[model samples]
Target: MNKTNSTKKTSKVGIVGGGVAGSTIALRLAEIGVEVVLFEEGASLVNGPPICHLHAGGNLYREISDQQCVDLLKQSIDTLRVFPHTANIRPTVIAVPKRDKGEPDALLSRLELLRNTYHSLIESDANNKVLGEPSDYFKLYDQDTLIELASRDFPSTPSSLDDWMIPVAKNLNLDEFKYPLVLVQEYGLSVFRIAATASLALSQMSHCKVLTTAKVNHLEQCESTSQWNVHYQQFDSTLGDWVTGYEHVDYLINACGYKTGTLDNLAKLPRERMVEFKAAYVTHWEHSQGTWPEVIFHGERGTPNGMAQLTPYPDGYFQLHGMTEDITLFPKGLVSSTAANAQPELSAPFIKKLTQHWQQDEVDLRSARAINHMAQFIPEFSSATIGGKPLFGAQQIPGTDPSLRAVDISFDGINYARTEIVKASSALSAADAVVDKLQKLQLITNDQHTSLELSFPITRSLTLEQVENFAEQLAEQRHYPSALARRVAF
Candidate 1:
């Protein structure tokens, strides 16, 4: 493949989805002079006024480290700085520690130790530059010190999570300093809408064709030429019908999240090689007053089980989400309506469990709202069997009550599965790299605060090269994935 000709040869890059991931990549590629074409299956709707929505879990930019803080300030100033018209507000997080009786004193002592250790580490040569000159901004305080400050103002009992958070807060000097999270202001109107609209604008600006309501159906691969023909269905507004057609492209980028069915057919990958899981996002209350929290709390109670995060936006609305867990909540197959709605009562219990664990006051349940209530399934491959036995079958195992569905594929057959799986797994490896980089920065702790461990079974069909490359990329990048320029051959 000639690099220069690859850039010139009608270089029509077909993007499957028009979400954030797709838009970001498209914009970057366009800036670099890549001929791009984007296809979206849904109609473009004007996204509502820019409401402050929280970023995904494990997003490292949320912290107040010197570099992150500076980066955030710069980003806000350059991109999200304008207020009133644009909404931008930063709220402070108040961490309360909850420990068993008589454990507060010990926990407080430990917190002091951790605080000092953190301070030392921050002051050390490697981190000193990132932490900046330690002034009152990055002060350290023992439990008594913080409690005294809190007693003078907002007094509250401490929880274990709180104990962990207080040191972090004090170390970062959350109090006294007027950090970015302190001010509540709107920088722009319809920023989210602007973001989505920007995608369309970018496509036009880049001279890339965007076809909405067009669903990709298949891919025709020529063995001789090693090229691909992408088939898609486009709805004809005039005819009030659908028309099918085909387009040629050198590579297929799957930006479709969780919807691997189309890619599965196009790539002709095996079914057992990929797994899918469901995740639910429920908004319990809307912020009517007060600013959002600066330090969003995302922590577990002891084990890696219950995960909850609280994101307070400038809109005075706080979004709290339950952690992702693998429970037999829904039936086996693509989670159906019956399975999702079967446990309406579970919502309250879920809220109660998180609130109790966090020791926060009962939020207004009446204010509860839910979206994407659908179950999320994640695909995994099984690589090996016990005693060198070949495992290639689907089994229905009956547990105490509900029966679970399990599929085992031989290690030899994964490449034959959907190429999307390979791409997705590789993408995950890249994401893991980012995670690892942040972890080294002490911004995130994996397998502790976040779930980075492979919980899904590996299919035996994945090649050693695929698995090793993915693992190597993941380990090298932590949890962050690599860029297209670095990972793919042009």
Candidate 2:
């Protein structure tokens, strides 16, 4: 273990975990001149194993709006352009049309309409820059045209919109119509890589320090200075276990990702208040000659078992991720164990089913090749799980679904809660330390009806429920309001 000292008076940010959330926040904070220290249990970016094999081309979707998606696409393009190796991460999308067994002509007409609509959307200024010279990569092949070229051909599969659109597709506007290759090219190889690079880029600009192999054991509040004292252990192959202590500004941020449960220990909240969800991945093959499909199937077939993603990665690799359900799949030590035993069984049958449907549509499967297989779990409904298990659904508030839970906390005496909120920090002495900052800053004010309102333009796509759950997680961690304060008018 090695020790370094910094007596700088700037706000010190200690970020736990070096994954996407942690690294991104650390880099952002560092860019703003804050003194930041990033701690990762694993090796830092250079020495760490590849985060994941999956490529996240759905960058256009996620939780944002169409306009926001466009903006994010542009941002992602600009960010990737700076890195030489990122050329492979450019954008590519392939559209596949599905037809009911008896409605071939109807499917063809729908395909044409979809193609036209997609072309219009892609041609729009919102997409022009990202699509580049449209003629270069954007070309359409009629179903008949594609079928004639294939050695084996069949009709398109039965397709429906209700199930496909309601959840994931609706979120991205892909549910509105069926089309091929909405926007496909190459992008980053994995969500983790994109996140890691973003973090590294941010770190380089901000002068923030990152310490790998450092796991925080606990945190303590200093009554004298009202600062946070952190106790952590650093591991090294050359050196034995080295325990160390450090102090940071009163504010702390928890971007721990799935390990968010760790925050419960450092704060006043019970572990049951958070919920964990799992997302499993399996790898398989398709022929390389066939172009990658643009439409991400969202329904049971698209997602598989109500909780999976069958996405195509670059270089003929496809990642078939299982459903997002309870975190039980991620029980202790399972992540590593699963990754080590990569097998076709984990995702083959699911991919086979998807491809079978594609084959009915006369799509070629031999074009894809499998390079690897893996699985992962994401902690969702974080405000509603305890000890890695979910709380009873009966305890859920009427309007708030337990599946989407949230937390809210307010000081007892304050007319308006104003405070700097920090999570997983040892700095909180009283509620005011977290809540008073917002109140004093006029971020939150007393109102008879609602507790808070936004005074500035805050752009986000999270639903009210998701926001509430996020806020609850912040509160559970003893952080002030997890989100910006909004004044509820009387």
Candidate 3:
């Protein structure tokens, strides 16, 4: 390893992880004239990745309980509105296609429960009038109408609340899959675009210093100065060697994703550290048309493992993702270390069960039985396996009369809803908190042209060759072009 030095500063920032959270903090702080040193273990911003509006993740609808967490999320959403790439974020459709009538009812109840998380969107809900499934989608369509609607082709946008929500015709895949489809309008994000746009926006600001090749060693605060010393590793691509260094900053923000949390002797932080493990698969197919929305399908054949997300791309590719609470990914009693293959006592079986869950093993189906068998076998992940929120009758009938009851509501999560909105909101809020800390320390003055305008120039266009080179530079240098780079290109 080699040694390097950055100009010592008391107020500099060293952010680890190049994902959405890290980038958002870097960009926002840099815009405010804070010298930020973003160190990513990855090559680029989206290089790890995600946006969309509304609550994109399942847990976001759940209670955070922590006031600071809620504040972070609120600030995150507000900050997202200003980014140019957010304009590309469109509304998403979460469809609950239930094989049984009771399933739809349970789905609505779950949504109603989610509504209880927020106060503004209250309603009478008489006769299930305003269930708040985006213009009361489930309420508007009855069993007969939904059954009839499902008999035809996927319907067009209906004459409903066209502002925030749009209702979809239940006739999607009519003959092949004849389930009552109850869809609500939510927002979906293309985080890659957000990352790309963020990188480009970062290029416009000269104050921020981003380093992609660095790896953080640890965090330590000096007792005397209260200054933070951020130790990291860097590779000299020229010499093909690694170097170690440190950045002394007055304040520290840990955007290091899941790896930062620690309890006793564990690979990552504790469960309450707000960490999760989400998996997704990408598939491509022929499509005769575009304009399809990202969909969350529950109580359907395709989603045998919890819930599945089908996010379609205009480029003809769709991604399938599975979301769950991550209390299991990190096992307690396991010491955190840099060694790759070395693991704790339960790591082997835990990873086995976890991977099987993601693969949806045909033999075991990655179900409760499989999980139980693993729990009995290993017992290490026993407590870890039990952290997800209950969907309340999500899997089966409540009591007797399985035919009369509906399955509980289900949703897919990508490790605590790592969408552009969630990431932006949470990250920006954290940035604001850091700024508050800096203000307490008097590191920055009141104002210095902080109002930065984010624009995607319409006049800028690059050739195919330039596009390829630009793309490479983006991944290598971790810089993206302005969001409008593709909007009005000639």
Candidate 4:
């Protein structure tokens, strides 16, 4: 139960949907002294999966391409330290499975070519003096280094059928892999990390209220007062049941992900086009097993929306994502030209397609396909049981209860953003953009009374590698934050 800030009680903003966008906005607004009330329809910030690459929970990569904030990803990654609920940075390995025709993937080929180029750059003293290590953020390992690193860091059962990719695939349980893995030093976007951190921040931030299990139903603006009346419902304890209530908010931000259309969506903002897809989360599959990087089986270009991705949590368990989005085929996944109108079997096929290479007979062939694909990387998956059945779905963002009355806050005073609702990273990026827009609109203002900003700047030429090495030295000597990063696995 958070109380509004008495000191900064002048401006109160209401945000609907406590997903990535809403949570980030709430934190930013609270920092700037705007009273925030974040309403989330879901009980938790990182809702249960059936997750996707639009899986927003973790990465704070600065090269978000859109330049929403050149440093937002860096700032977002920093939250792993500022907040207690998240995991620190870990070296992410991207293994591209071998392609057909006895050749490496064109993308991987280019990546290897780039690595050679970077090696040349590092070796060139003139270039180092000129470019200053543009490859500082990554640790691009060659075939032998990747194999040795994987074998040392994540030791699992070596595969039997290893030839060319043998060096990189030596210790990894995956029978499928590419040589010279791409090791990203600061790559990862974890949903659980964002959920825990954001929820904790919302709980602790002054003048902020995070209302879970609350659904917005109606929105009406008071033209005279310039405030919006927000009507929402929630299960109230004192009332002994569900109750409807209203709050008068100075600014209303619709950060609702997929449910934006249920209300009168904001004009001029990009519209998020969501499609139904199927995916799975397996907990028991690598129960108390070895660590693995975020493994993505590369699909055709720009087809992650319909591809397979395996992501690991801080706990070492993994979520395997696949999509059954072939709309022309009936029952969804079975896109056979002849069986177009076949019976819809649901998630079994999506999971199967995800785990196609590995073989499992326990669940029907339709379902086992997905599980088997996962078993290649996670051998325990072959023996492990499913935690929960996979389901066909779309964005995991809070959905409007069809039974409840609907609201359209984007009428007059309220504002909304309609960018594609992918993962939590995009949400935070979107929030930054929204905050920028609000700053221009005079809806957001910095606090005059807040504590003075940190003005210290260090004068040093220590490279990023040096700083990281120093951190590692400190981590070894004083092992505290290391638990959040290195010792995270049980």
Return the top candidate by TM-score: 4
- Candidate 1 yields a Cα-based lDDT of 0.32
TM-score, one value per model: 0.45, 0.46, 0.58, 0.61
Using lDDT as the measure, name the better of candidate 1 and candidate 4.
4
Residue 38 in model 4: lDDT: 83
lDDT of model number 4: 0.44
By lDDT, the best candidate is 4
lDDT of 3 by residue, 359-473 (tens): 3342123233323322332233122221111111001111222121111111111111111222434444445555555555576543332222321121012123344334345
Q: Rank the candidates by TM-score, best first.
A: 4, 3, 2, 1
Alpha-carbon lDDT of model 2: 0.33
Evaluate candidate 3 by giving its C-alpha RMSD to the native, one decimal.
12.9
Model 1 regions lying over 4 Å from their true place:
1-6, 45-194, 197-200, 270-289, 294-305, 324-490
Q: How much lDDT does each candidate structure score?
A: 0.32, 0.33, 0.40, 0.44
What is every candidate's alpha-carbon RMSD to the true fold? Answer: 18.4, 17.2, 12.9, 11.5
lDDT of 4 by residue, 317-407 (tens): 4455543222111244321111222112235554444334224443234245555655555455566445433322334222222111111
Off by over 4 Å in 4: 1-8, 48-85, 100-136, 139-168, 171-180, 224-226, 265-272, 285-290, 301-307, 313-316, 323-367, 376-381, 388-393, 396-421, 447-490
Candidate 3 overall Cα lDDT vs. reference?
A: 0.40
Per-candidate clashes, comma-separated: 71, 60, 18, 16
Better of 1 and 2 by lDDT: 2
